[model samples]
Target: MLKYLMLVVVFVGSSWVHPMHVSVCEINFNQKDHSLEFTHHIFIDDLEKSFRQSFNKPYLDINNPDVGKTTDELVAAYMKKHFKVTVNGKSALPKYLGHEVENDAIYTYMELDGVKTLSSIRIFNDVLTEVYDDQVNLVHVEIGEDISSMKLTPQRKIDELKF
Candidate 1:
């Protein structure tokens, strides 16, 4: 009995642990500006890996002086391919603003201008899904006082929120 218990402990201790694969996105409708502000929070390591794979680059250093511009370009292109938004059933491509690295995560900003009214929003966020099978993307939308949230996974990549 003691041998079996020891074996169980060893097996549990030696088991491989998978890293957490998740990204958070926040979309807010700015009534005064008539625009939809988008912010995405992603792990820096994961983003670098995805960028490397997508761009076929050997290395991507986030701290390099010249890397900021290249990183922004890569991020914008990646977002354009992986993330999308439709307001009131009309497809609107967001304008890439910029990105900032905070601690271990990267925050990407974008905007969809001329959004006068928002009745429904369709979001398709597949960031890192191609690389990580267990990737999960969480999205939160704030339209005035009303709010909506959705969880996107590999199987279900798109979700429509009605406000």
Candidate 2:
């Protein structure tokens, strides 16, 4: 079901004003590198709407360059505010590497270093929930050889998994 949903969202996410308000996040712990990887998939239109509404700016163009920041930087800041990850009860701040724009959606990448072990993982993702009441964020966490998934909505923004 998750794979089917992901396929649908990726194929049709470029269109403007879709009924579904959703985002996808993938977290992986790299044992060799001792780091945590985060990848977020979000619609371009919905992200722009979030920026405009949150910043109170009428004309915020994510595709075009702004004097304040590049599109990826702007998005990274937003993600830093809306998305959080806690490992073993300690919160981590990830470094935003960059983003990729495909069709009507953008894929953002972030990484946290020096995370050698993981006993418990908690994710708080409220991306675009303020703009859309029905917003849903799907999170997939990978630790060692196991993968765990969770669905986040406006009413519930956080989920925890124990290793």
Candidate 1 lDDT, 1-163, residue by residue in tens: 4333533343333334325677878898999999999999787778888867765778877555244467788788889999999899999899999999876678899999999988899999999998899998988888777667889999999999887
| Top candidate, metric TM-score | 2
Candidate lDDT values, in order:
0.82, 0.85
Query: What is the alpha-carbon lDDT for the whole of candidate 2?
Result: 0.85
TM-score of each: 0.82, 0.88
Candidate 1 at residue 159, lDDT?
Answer: 99
Kindly report which residue stretches of model 2 are placed more than 4 angstroms away from their true locations once superposed.
Answer: 1-17, 65-67
Task: Name the 10 consecutive residues with the lowest summed lDDT in model 1.
Answer: 9-18
